[model samples]
Target: MTNRHQKYEVLDGLRGIAAISVMVMHFLQDLSVPVLQSAYLSVDIFFILSGFILTHSYGDKLHHALGIGQYLKMRLVRLYPMICIGLVIGAISLCAMKLDGAAAFSVGNFVSAVGENFLLLPYLGDMSVGSFIRTSAHGVPTLGNAGNFPLNPPEWSLFFEMFASLLFVAAIRFDRRSLLKAAYASLALFVVYGMMIGINEGKLTIIVNQGWRADNFVGGFFRVTYGFLIGVAIRKMLDSDGAPHAYWMSGRLIRSARALFVAFLLITLFPTSIKGLYPLAILVFVAPMLIFQGAKLRPGGALSARACSFVGWLSYPLYCVHYPVGRLVFTYLPNSEQHIVGAAALACGLSIAAAAVLAKCVEEPVRRYLMKRFAGAASRSAAPPVRAA
Candidate 1:
């Protein structure tokens, strides 16, 4: 029997893959290459994984040993360090652009953007109106049309992830039946929101491009809610006494499962004209299936296990830092269509290196310090008061 607290290495590897896909998608887009068209869907994978992993790790603790304040503190320690690193990178990138005269940069607007984004709040400016006082002034339009978190577009997802965490904590008191009801309610809301978006966009398929702007901000909520809760439900299933047996745990079958999982993600994320229910289907079915399978799959060997663990360790830092790093490289480097392919390739390598540095050198140390400090504070606060004799 597997240890309940052991890390799901396969899920971690899949998460790293998803993070890479997102980084590549953004890099290609910046270079005007139209590949990985559906890679934004990788964010859905992240939401699912977040739900699954968080539930697996904290489902019982939150109900017993962990208090709400302490849980939030742990989460903040895990997430906020990288966010600060990303914001600093973004600020530096903007300053570089201003120095290079590539775009206009306004200190006031940038300061405002930084302040809001640092708080993980969305930028409420008119992103389309690229003028001196708006998004353009902060160099956000050049990056990606000024999303909600103009400083770091991917940060919008992080915002939703944190929101989902809070929601998950709030529902900790729910019984199994109540949890299922909550999941179904969230699913219904997601479907309704998708249908509305599809109708308005004049597309038969559910639009996946959301949660980044003022107009489609609400869509982000439904997207994350559905995916995250589904993940939670799947975790509950896996934890139950009647959970399905993994008959496919043999070496050959394990390899096949790993291969198929990678192939399926590639196929789903590649450019395709197949629309309509495709995106919604992936979220509703594909993502959860992968998580369920990932939870059951073991690495075929020690080397493979180590590799997966490394990538999983790198995933969050990579995702958080890649956009700004790539943007910096693309902005300063040669980026003609012919040359840009090479430039993007180089940027990818550099992004990996940067992620490693940030993760090991910066994020880890900061998080350790913060967690240690928080733990000390919590222990002291919980200590008994001295009695005067």
Candidate 2:
């Protein structure tokens, strides 16, 4: 592929790795394993990647050719199919829980949860009553505190993602200098916000988990904005005349860099402690470095390229659906300390399988159909009428 059209296969692979790390982290959290405590930071990695990739893919188009409505439609088409699948799976799991006496069923709350989640909105109702009963009675798994998107907690990121996409489009209209200034301003605001919260709570760490609840939702906006803008800045740099060529590094060095990138990501995610400003540093500095490096490093061979593409294709589906699917697994399986590890492993395996099936059998087909249908309608509407002779 030409440079303009080339896919950053290494970045794709890294994204898949991040998604799996998050899945494992969630399972372990439910099972009471203290490992990978900071894996929730994977959402930051996602924000950066989304900014970088969308800028690369749609920056020029958004500025020159694509309309705001069409751009949003494209995003919805790409994202909503998997979201629907996740919502359906979550609803089914909730029903099963109620039927099996694992959870209390409230028709009003249940219907509200399904309706809100179906629209990609967080369920704001008081789930504190029936929701925690499962956790209390049977030791069934929960993501703690009925987060913003309680049905599928990880979807909190997706909500921020959509919001950030709109922000990105709006910001891209500015000149490069103005864009950079905006990004810097966002960074400043984020640091100030983090410090204020940390100091008020008498903690030294930058808060990474935000936007999952009503109180700290603003933090989520700052978190995603800063990360996304960093990504956009990296893309802008790479697109400039002085930027390094993709082939500047030798293939062997690129491969080594890829390995090191993965190692750094794992080290950052599997932190033993959440103290200090390291998490903030990683979000502000390390994530952009990874994106810049990944953009420059292509996959090594045909087999490697195929693997990267496959994993990248699988990442979104895996991320969207993993929580509900794994929750169901943990609900049914024994989650005792001895068997918890086994259960977590099984949950991960089953989640991957379900994600793959959904991607291949459902998400892909629906997206293609929607794109074709919408594109044809758009073209027809844009075409002018001919006069008869």
Candidate 3:
């Protein structure tokens, strides 16, 4: 097993910031600022991070028996606890939203949704089964994810993460050549998909993010394919695509400081460009740059390092709990900007507290169990001891 010390401190901090960006973006977009409009790009950052971490950890070991199984277990242990909690919270909040008249309730779908919301596979069934975001002509709410009432909207990204991770395991078990081919093919598909979104919007664009629809969900697929493969490609290129080469990037054109700046800017600043092309710039350049630089980060001072670690530790559960926390609060509080500042602050605090609870009570324990029982077994199986003659 790789040492925990080897984990990238800067990337963890970036993820914490990104997770906060996502939550804040969701919270404030309706309240009028919308400065975090670009925060959705954080999804791409996550995809890149996933690919980088997965390849670094398992690229060479995937050919061994149990490697894939254990990898899946580790990922599931990390994901499922928070997912179940989010879904439960979402389901209960669905009733609350209905009472608040944010949505019209259906008993059958609610029961089914309570049962099926945890399905990790987006392709098997419609992800819109329980969505309740209102459809309106205005851009504000219209741009929202319109499925799965009170269910964590961001869970859709995790669905893509699961699918992409499965594909990554498959590629790793195959030869490097096959993985390269798959990456190229997926990239081609993403380009075609991006072009379609751009043409429809009259510029380079791709907007199907964290949404579930018959047609729009395809956008998420293309987005994931591009982001995840770029991650794999970057790691592979840094390693000279499996050939012998020095891993340090030449001349260090980009540094971890630049990475921190760019990632923060993407999440927090307004993109002063043709809006349609923003996602293109992020997916094509910025996200990958952040990952590359993040990989190269040297540990900073103790205070900064601890802050980064705390943010990283807070990120996952923060992400998992934010949407449901927002829903519950807004159900009782007004959804409009009537008390925008106070509303956002309250949602942020509640979400962070909920995340801390979940991380402490759920993810940590589940991960410890999986690590104790399966991590070693999986690692051992991947490089089984040779029997003596």
What lDDT is obtained when candidate 3 is compared to the true structure? 0.63
TM per candidate: 0.85, 0.85, 0.81
lDDT of residue 93 for candidate 1: 69
Q: Write the per-residue lDDT of candidate 1 for residues 1-389, one digit (tens) a residue.
A: 33446677777778787788888777676333476777788888888777777776667677567677787777787788899898899778666655654445477767788899999888776432221112122334333256777666788899998898898886656554566667668767777776778788887865566787877889888778777777776677665633334322322343544674565567545666355366666666556667777777777788887877788888898888887776677566643334656767887899899999988888889877997888445422322211000
Off by over 4 Å in 1: 30-33, 98-106, 127-144, 175-177, 202-204, 241-257, 335-337, 376-389
Compose the digit string of candidate 2's lDDT tens values, residues 1-389: 12445567777887887888888777776444466777777788888888777776677677456677877777777778888888888777766666555555378988887788778787766553223223323544332355667677788888888888788878666655565677678777777776677777888765557777655677888888887777776777777633234323323343553574556566545665456366766775566666777777767788888877777777899998998887677566653335667877887899999999988998889987986776434422221201000
Which runs of model 3 end up more than 4 angstroms from their true locations?
1-5, 121-145, 148-150, 173-181, 194-212, 241-259, 266-268, 271-275, 334-336, 370-376, 379-389
Off by over 4 Å in 2: 30-33, 98-105, 129-143, 196-205, 241-257, 272-276, 335-337, 377-389
Output the lDDT of residue 135, model 2: 31
lDDT of 3 by residue, 362-389 (tens): 7678766866676666654332211000
Error of 1 at 80 (Å): 0.1
